[model samples]
Target: MARLPVNHPARPIYRVLSGLVGLYILVFGVWGTVLTWGEPPFARDGAWALGLRANLAFALVSVIFGIVLIVGASRRGNLGHYMNLTAGVVFLVTSILMMSVLQTSANFLNFSMSTVIVSMLFGLILIGTGAYDKVGPEEHAEEARKHRFHPVAEVHRRR
Candidate 1:
């Protein structure tokens, strides 16, 4: 099937979902760093197995991630969808794991219960926007009309 362009309005929503998620993460990372500054880079009150703290390193990464989304906002269709899909999956898993586990009293970006919920929502948005077909019926028919009779299946030649 012929896929619609990212901005085609036929299908694809990463522009908004990713932009929001990216902005949130970016802000969270910066806020976390500001709060945890002057403290250890890797503290006992950190998330993840490697004791990943919300210090300078994490904050930089977050900023960079945010910039990527904001800059790539105009990117439509396949590439954008795939990127968001992958990121969404990763974030979903990590967030679920973090929420499920009962660890030490540590706060990354001052995350509360609401934060976790928001993260979950973000992940879902990414997945929904990326995974599903964004093409509308009218657009699909138009595309069909344009490519009608064209061979989409590859033909193999015997040597």
Candidate 2:
């Protein structure tokens, strides 16, 4: 099998940025979990509740993706993996919508700013990861045919 070549011009930058964003997500997740620990009463009932729940769910998903990124970044192949991009897009859109609806008082400025910053960073990481994956090299497992192993390369190839 032919050896896979390095694909990106800034692959290392992508990996480092993506990993840093992933770490940020993990930290934000812990912070959010702590903040929302109690069954506090939500402000709105219908649309607001829906938005809140969706945002919460998306944040949780972001945390999961963060963990995946931390693991994926250490290995070969693209730093911004497919799962990371998918989750990041979902998170970015949902978060912006939720924040717009949830912010009522100036007291929430800090919270709002933090959310936007993190969401934007996540979006950038996602886009970068997607680009990297589109151009990055993948190693074949042909040499490992003697062993009973299914390679990640084959799985991604189908996509």
Candidate 3:
């Protein structure tokens, strides 16, 4: 059971950042999709969009993911927290998985080193946003703040 901040002061900023990342992903996906139109889903034809190598398959997936992120960011509940966390992990894992097969035929996403780096960066950002975007009642928030530096004592007190 990990403890997270409640009603964090920087919540708005994190939400905005999350939205921006989603916008970038959406734009990249749309551009990539148009550029890779009429090509094979996994073609290695060297198409680039927003500095990331992409193919039809990857582009379509990005579109969906981007939409999800945007929706999550726009929400005013914990949905964004969960979504960001999940997206962050997914991005991180995908970057590593793709990087592993960078030069092999298994690189169906046509990922380049740049793509891996960007994905990793996005992952970390999303995770950070998720960490501090939780919302709760004022009382809970006050308790959280009081225990911010002594979580063990807080847990014991709760028990």
- Ranked candidates, highest TM-score first: 3, 1, 2
CA lDDT scores, all candidates in order: 0.58, 0.53, 0.93
Residue-pair clashes per candidate: 5, 0, 0
lDDT score for residue 127 of model 2:
65
- Provide the global lDDT of candidate 3 against the true structure: 0.93
lDDT, candidate 1, 57-90, per-residue tens: 5566667876665554446535666767777786
Clashes of 1: 5
lDDT by residue for model 3 over 21-119, one digit each (tens)? 999999999999999999999899889998999999999999988999999999999999999999999989998997999999898889999999999
Q: What is residue 63's positional error in candidate 2, in angstroms? A: 3.4
Residue clash pairs of candidate 2: none
Candidates, ranked, lDDT: 3, 1, 2
> Candidate 1, TM-score vs. the true structure?
0.58
